[model samples]
Target: MRHRVSGSRLNMPHSQRVALMKNLARELFEHGTIVTTVTKAKELRPFVESIITRAKKATTITQELGTKSTGSPEAMELKSRNLALRREINRNFNDRKLVKKICDEVAVKYLTRNGGYTRIVKLGMRRGDASEMAVLQLVDSEEKKETK
Candidate 1:
């Protein structure tokens, strides 16, 4: 009867699953990479991509708006108008800055890649529960020699 179930449950409850995803996403953003299970890495790919896509779109919008605003004589007319426009642009810039930093510096490191941003190296099995173990990492670091 599990006909329409789309995503792996990983035997976790809904809230915990969401929290885990969020935490993983945050870690990936902060570290530009992570080591996790294959299943988790596969799941995190689309989730992280969506965030990066939104950030790229936001940056595009900011660029377009900045170009439009600065091209008009009205932008130079009144101080208040200029201030308002600057405020709007600044808000957009701030939003895009965080996105750009994460997307450009972190995500772009994997730019040539079409997909498969992560890799999974099987690590045998867990001791307690005997579940399969794997190490999931960002693909860009694949060639970097492991220190230990």
Candidate 2:
């Protein structure tokens, strides 16, 4: 019936789909944006959001704990705490770095705002595959200015 089915399969197997999503996420983090099919963008939104939300929560916890500020006795301790948090969120260094960047640079820039951390702009269709294309980017003025 496919009634309760969630998430698009993109016709790929389970393991391949996970791998594809992970790679796309890594690339998106590294580039601060990416252009892909609209379907992929939709799927990637929640996946990426979960990571950002975790980072945000971690940041909030550190802030509340008064541990991560500069020129403090607990600064080194907070650094270790952040490192552990990063490792928990993403096992690899590249992914960890991306998460940290997203948390410190991207998320902080939008702290005053609510959710909807990303935007997907449709770019018509691809020439060869005729697939729908869209650009997904972080919702921040600095990124907009940098790209423009």
Candidate 3:
């Protein structure tokens, strides 16, 4: 009856599905916006949000530990937390620059926001494939407004 099952298969095998999600997510982060199929956007929302959340947590931890004395136990703990989050994120995002952007800049931008990092806007259908299309973008922040 299709109950309790989660995540769209996206007509691809497990490996391919993971790869697609990774690429979609990376592109979305890099460009701040992307247009893809609606189904894919829905599937990607949670994936991207989780990474942003992780980055946010790491940023908080670093800030809290910054004032504390280095070489202390808390400092070591903060270092480990940052490293773990980076390792987890690096698996999907191969680019070092993008990873840095998320950890250093993006995380700081989202520090006050609890969640809901990405937005989805339906864009009708693709003419070639008739696929329902959507635009997925990072929610705008004050910093972004100034940069434009």
Candidate 4:
């Protein structure tokens, strides 16, 4: 019966599922890594990746334009494009500071790479329910490794 349906419902209603994802994403952004159910981690991977891509795009636009915030028509156009990307991301995330951090810092770190922003590591099973658990984390950028 369930042939082409995409995405797990997680046995939750639509609103709750969205809220759960939002909370998980917020925590993941703040801490860099989170331990969660395997199922949740799988679902969160694509969601987080897409957001990072958008943030990366915004960062890219700003970088390409550099300090040219005004004057030229091209600069204005790029600025608008960057603003639109940020606004789209802001719609999903509640905290402005978090959104800023994503665009300015997190995305910048991954600008050199393409996709594969997150990694999910299996952590065996939870004792209470025996559900499979995993650690979802952002992949470390090469720049950070060189600095350390």
RMSD of each: 7.7, 4.2, 2.0, 1.7
Top-lDDT candidate index: 4
Scored by CA lDDT, what does every candidate get?
A: 0.59, 0.77, 0.89, 0.93
Order the candidates by lDDT, highest first.
4, 3, 2, 1
Better of 3 and 4 by TM-score: 4
- Lowest lDDT sum, 10 consecutive residues, model 4, at 62-71
- Candidate 2 — which residues are off by over 4 angstroms? 67-85, 92-94, 141-148
Q: TM-score, each model?
A: 0.59, 0.77, 0.92, 0.93
Residue-wise C-alpha lDDT for candidate 1, range 1-148, written one tens digit per residue: 7899777887899878777877777777667567667677667677766655444444444444565666566434433443444344334334445454654465545544556655567787678887666665555644465643
Cα lDDT tens digits for candidate 2, 13-132: 998888888888788777889999999999999988777776776676567557446767677767677667767667532555676786677667665556788899999989999999
Could you tell me how far off, in angstroms, the CA of residue 84 lies in candidate 2 after the best superposition? 6.0
Q: Whole-model lDDT, candidate 2?
A: 0.77
Winner on lDDT between 1 and 4 is 4
Instruction: Check candidate 1 and list the clashing pairs.
Output: none
Whose TM-score is greatest here?
4
lDDT by residue (32-90, candidate 3, tens digit) is 99999999999999999999998888788878788879889988988898888887888
Clashing pairs in 3: none
